[model samples]
Target: MNSSVEKCHMFHESAVDLLTSIDFCESTLKTSIFFVAFNPIFWNIISRLEYYTHFLTKLTRNPRTGCYVLAVTIFSLGLVRNYFFEQALYKQGVTGVLQNEVAKVLGVALIIIGQVLVLTSMYQLGIIGTYCGDYFGILMKERVSAFPFNICENPMYRGSTLSFLGISLLQGKSAGLLITFFVHMVYEIALKFEEPFTMKIYRNPKKD
Candidate 1:
């Protein structure tokens, strides 16, 4: 009986140790995810504000400079977003939180559809299409009623939002969903601020 008690105590200690290690791992993963997620969101808000202020004005000026600035802004955003995305995946992998075969297929499908919506908008609208046109002051053509534009009122913005969600699901990262939510919020704000101003710009011009 004494021997059995000793063995049971030993097993208990071993189980506690294993659980402790798992807890440590979970803490590290959460911390890592938080750090990676922060930077892109910071830059996105900053750049989006700056970009909107300059977009329309810049558009009316030399398109070369306008394009350059747009490219810089978008590229910067892409890099940061990618890093966050990578970190989300890393955390999920560590936690074994990813979806299995069925989810994998669904995630892939959403990703493709979302990308199509986004890229279609870009292709139909060009650089100005995917970005806030207010910075350069370059109004898009009178109409953008084509491709992805037809599918969603703000295809570029919605597509981007979808892309984030799709990628997150594909990566099996629950944190990715939160990040995507933030992206959508930001884009929605930008859309509300930007779309009317642009419509007015083009609309007034025709009236003149």
Candidate 2:
């Protein structure tokens, strides 16, 4: 009877440790998501402001250059966000059946598909169209209805979120799933502003 009680105590302690680790990981994941969400919203607002103020345009002396600057800034922030996401995953404790080979394979497949969608979309859009060049009077001739875009309205955002999920699965991290959901939410909110503003730019076809 004493041996059984000791075993139960050990099991309870282990479970408590696991729960504590999960809580820590979740808090870190939330911070990473916050930065990831903030990046797009920050750039979108800044780009729109630049469109009206021309501060970036005057500094760069070319609208395209300013757009490129913004793109680079966004890209750098993205790298940082990803780094934090990976760190959060590393901090998380693996649980359940997600650590199996089948899950790993599925995660790899999802990553591959996500990469294909992202790369193809970028190739079709080019740097100008891929970034917020429309804000600088650089507009695409028409909307691109390619393979990925044909399937979904925002393939890039969708693909990115998928990639995040894939990475989470590969790591068997539940925190990753939460972060992925936040990523999707942030992209959806961004689109609410981005899509309409882009359409207005095309409709007007004049730079301020």
Per-candidate TM-score against the hidden true structure: 0.64, 0.85
lDDT of 1 by residue, 64-84 (tens): 466556567766757765675
Top candidate when judged by TM-score against the true structure: 2
State the lDDT at 54 in candidate 1: 50
Q: Please list the residue runs of candidate 1 whose C-alpha ends up more than 4 Å from where it truly belongs after superposition.
A: 1-61, 93-98, 204-208
Count of backbone collisions within predicted model 1: 15
lDDT of 2 by residue, 47-165 (tens): 89887887888999998998899889888998989998988888777855466898788889889888888888899898888878888777788889988889987888888988998
> Please, what is the whole-model Cα lDDT of each candidate in the order they appear?
0.60, 0.82
lDDT of 1 at 31: 51
Residue 31's C-alpha lDDT in candidate 2? 76
Error of 2 at 91 (Å): 1.0
